[model samples]
Target: MSDSLAEHVHYLGLANRSDLYRSAISDCIAPDDTVADLGCGVGVLGIFCLEVGASHVWGIDSSDAIYLAQETVRKAGLDKHYTCIASSTFRAELAEPVDALICDHIGYFGIDYGIIDMVRDAAKRMLKPGGAIMPDKLVLQIAGVSSDACHEKAAAWSDDIVPKVFHWIDEQARNTKYPHEFAPGELCSAPVELGQITLNADTPEYFSFEAEIEITSSGRFDGLAGWFKSHLGNDVWMTNSPLDPNGIKRSQAFFPIARPFDVQRGDRISVTIRARPEGNFLAWDITPRGGPTQKQSNWATTILAEADRATLDGPLRLNDNAQASQYILSLVDGQRTAAQIEETVMRDRPDLMPSQQGTRNLVRDILKRCAVS
Candidate 1:
């Protein structure tokens, strides 16, 4: 495993936050119930289920951590009761329906990792008619925050650089989403529940939410701070909100405004958030009371320059690159193998395929993308 992934697994394995999950599993699992543990890192939750008297547990994870999960089950002498599948829970199939579905796919804020869609699909496919889902509901919370330190960290690339270079770098950074930690004192407004999703029911992949937050203190509004509250089971829940005294140690989402604005205690901040499950994109528009609206999206941070926007909006046509791709694709007539195609392309278009190794790589990439499975 990569060092980062190993460290992540190790940290999560030892996080005190996991105690909430263990307690919930112990309280919810029945003696004869079968559990499906999605994204089961080290099989900890699955083994906990077995220890709590679950009949069996199916642990699924797409990473190499699944092997460690299997090993953990064996070490616990519960190998006969736990089965680890080294595949994404979305793609894996179960022979029998499970009595409960357990997953810890929630990202830093809440739905950043596409857990909403994953859990919804698992409930439809692998869950029994009346099966329960851990963390049955999720609530997304948002509040206006005044944190010059956090804003400076995000906008660091804009300093001491040429205008064009800084714009490019800033654009790239804004396009990419990141989790940011916020100190309690940074909160400028009371939190508002933006949205909620019940995991046991079918849900749309796209969600739109709008909420108005009342500014509780006077400060500059630099961005919106976001967190999540997950209901694990009866009277068992976990949250990352700084306002929650019992909240876990987790990063919060900070959606920065293009420009900071001052606000008073009575001013209101209106927020509209649109979420796309496929790319985990979050688009937000903030309109402070009597202030101009500012729009930002996680996928594309800033509005493109006029010239760039015009070029992108222009009609599409095949260029020299497209013509070359067409020629290469024409060579795949189902009669010649990929090797033969590469040889012919190398001989005919040496300008595109300069080296034999490069030609092989180009052909392999083309086939991997265009070949019929």
Candidate 2:
């Protein structure tokens, strides 16, 4: 099977994940309620909404998996109650606001994949007053761990090996966060709650939190382990914590330090984590009470890049691509269907769009930028 199909298969097989969402959505939805499933993978959440008596469920996704989702809904005999839209939640518009908006965009650390910004936008424009936002809260926790396996992957670039992992990759590998499953004894320090995110609230562009973690066992402080408990609502929740037997086995986020340092029982380590400016961590500082500190940032890249400041800084002129796009968009004057517009564009602008598939892709991509219902 293809990777995309395999992914959806995996999603469908995640009984732990599906159960929580199913229960939570069932608790909140009524027979007359309309629901929106953003990033509706396999349409399972939307189907759960329908099964629980939601009136009309809209499942929006940007991938071609939308076709698979449509088929899934039809196969379940829920086509009449469901509508699958092949568009990004950022671009997809709903006709008449939904009574609730649900999404499964919570990343490993609970707040990655730009879900916060997307949910913030949806809450404002898509949901009705007091509309439910499932998994409204993400409770973050962190602990120090010792794992040769986890450290080796991040430190591999520094090894004197033949294939030559670039020296620059050392910075990126160590700085970037990873997902790991910690053995019961892997943790050197007792896990502590770091912070949380309420999905619908106005959150800061950058969120930072510091903690003093005390070691409970003797081991090398290889890195920090982070996980979250997502509150899906109505007493239903799921977590990726290593110790939770009932939680989803999705693992936890791990950040490898530059060097492995030794720590003993009762030793305190100071840690400060900065997350956001977009989903992932920007920087993390780990310092042993009386030893050296390891500080890393994802922003520090090896490549020298130029800033983009064209239309933002001054007068704008549309290029051929933008011009063709704008002219095709003009065809969507509230009377023509997307298919009608595509045929018109392919016929009228043979010079601009030579191939049929290319013309269709272009027209549909341009349509992704509009918020038409």
Candidate 3:
């Protein structure tokens, strides 16, 4: 099966995940409500809205999965109530504002997946004033772990296994986040509520917080684990926390340290987590009282995929694509239609333009960034 097909199948097969989403959508959506499923994978959530009597449903996805979503809705005889938008959230334009917004962008660690940015942008541009958002609030939790494998996994830099010239690769591996494979029972410290997230006018571009974890059991402190509790309104809630019985069937993100140390009951550890503006770059510091701190940050260890230093440090200049982009964006004035703008670009900037098909993609790419609302 294709990647998208396999993803949809996995989502559908998740135990109790769909049932909970169906319940949440049904509770908030009314018969006359128009719902938009932002990042709708296979439009499963959009179909749920239709089954619950929504007047119309919009399935918005950045992938070709939207095509399959259209087919799925048609196969269910619910095509009349649904429309597929084959665009990313940045480029998607709705005929009218939606009454509710639902999405699947929330990652295992909640805010790490960028639900804040998606919800904030969607609410400002596409949602009605009083629009209801599924899983409106999220609570982030953190805990200290005691796992043999977690520490062993991070201390992977061996002369036999890897050469000294490529030590940087092992360093990057140590700073990266891994899927939490261990259970909650391995927790050395009680899970503490690090922060909460709700997208609104006042929400920050990314999350930053620090908290203290009090050790509850005597064990080796290997690393830190992160999870989330999501409130879907109407008394419905779900979590990916290993400790929560009703957590969605998903793995949490575990941050491992290079050296594992012993901690006794009542010991304290200071934990700090930070994210870049878009939440793509993550960093954390785990420090034990009176001991050395182990810092794990993708920005610190990884060079290639991290932010561009030149852009941040100096005056930048736009290239040819940017010049073409500027001309295309100027046409996005309040008055001109998309078709009208396309025709104008073809006539005026033939030198900067590509072939018939490439021109369309170029124009669409340039203007979509500014197409809020």
Candidate 4:
């Protein structure tokens, strides 16, 4: 690989925060536990797991970085306990059932690299039933704004590709910098559903999404801001355009931003996002065709707490809100329990126990409604 490409891959190995991952796997580890790091990418996280006393650690990656990870293992003299595999996550075989799975395959907005879905599938095949995943939760957020700095960076693409941003992003791959930008305080922390990434994979090759979004703030919005915030356990997490670490930036975690787009106060900007698999990640396009933009796929709710609601065409019935409605919805996927969800919410909003209770109740109610639907 060229020096820059190698640098980017290597950076991925070191750039991530291992402390968060270490703390996450601590609870799930046993002396003889078998662990698999999906999309291992140079095996830094796996190394940390081994250091913390995991018995057997396997790191899997589709990229060339698997070799680098192997070298790192040998250099660390960990060859006996840690193993590296150079193959696509979907096709890899394991020596035994895994006790836990660690995956940080998340990309900008959580879907670009198909990591989340990969996690779900890998977890299904590799992990023992009830085995935990490192990141228990992930969320995507969105907002409206035209950013000049963002436009300028995306415009720096080579002559081999089109100069405009947000259209056919795959053609702009030469620009190593990830395209797309987020404006200050412009994100709507929307609730998301699982399968956001998997649905795209099932979508026909020529697929797209269009929506109307009203700009809440008047700024030169050259494009939309999309990002994913992930919590590795009950305690550790990271966010693109993070609210805690101002200016730490998400480190190129966005895609398909528009170029030199302009917007005014009360202006409704219509936006569309398109995607297809390219290389190891999903390639996409974002277009502003009209009004306030709709939320991006990653930012929108996928599995609604009320998705199973039974609808009656006969009449509009006013259903009373109950605690069960929310509770059931929260537990629909079997991925999270009521107590776990409560703990997560409490960590983020410590003073809102009542609100959390109400939210959980509503979730159960929604699930009940969906079940009857």
The best candidate by lDDT is: 2
lDDT of 4: 0.57
Clashes of each: 0, 0, 0, 36
| Predictions: Cα RMSD each | 5.4, 4.1, 5.5, 20.3
The digit string of per-residue lDDT tens for model 3 on 1-373 reads 2999988788788666887898888788899899889999889898888888899998998787888998888898888899998788877899899999997777868877767788888898889998999878888889999887777677666445778777656777778788774586778888999988775455865568899999999989888898888888798887877776666777788887766789999999999998753557888988999999888887756576443544566766787888888888888888887777878888877667557668877877676655633
Q: How accurate locally, in lDDT, is each candidate?
A: 0.81, 0.82, 0.81, 0.57
Best by TM-score: 2
Deviation of model 2 at 356, angstroms: 14
Sort all candidates by TM-score, best to worst.
2, 3, 1, 4
Cα shift from native, residue 64, model 2 (Å): 2.1
C-alpha TM-score for every candidate: 0.79, 0.83, 0.81, 0.58
On residues 1-373, what C-alpha lDDT tens digit does candidate 2 reach at each position? 2766887887667648888888888788878799988888678888888888899999998876788889988988889989999888988898889998888877777876667877888888899988888878888888998888888877877777825646767877787777788886888889999888898788888889898899999978898998889899879988988888887777678888887888899999999988882575457899999888889777654344343423467776877888987898788888887778878887888566667787778888887666264
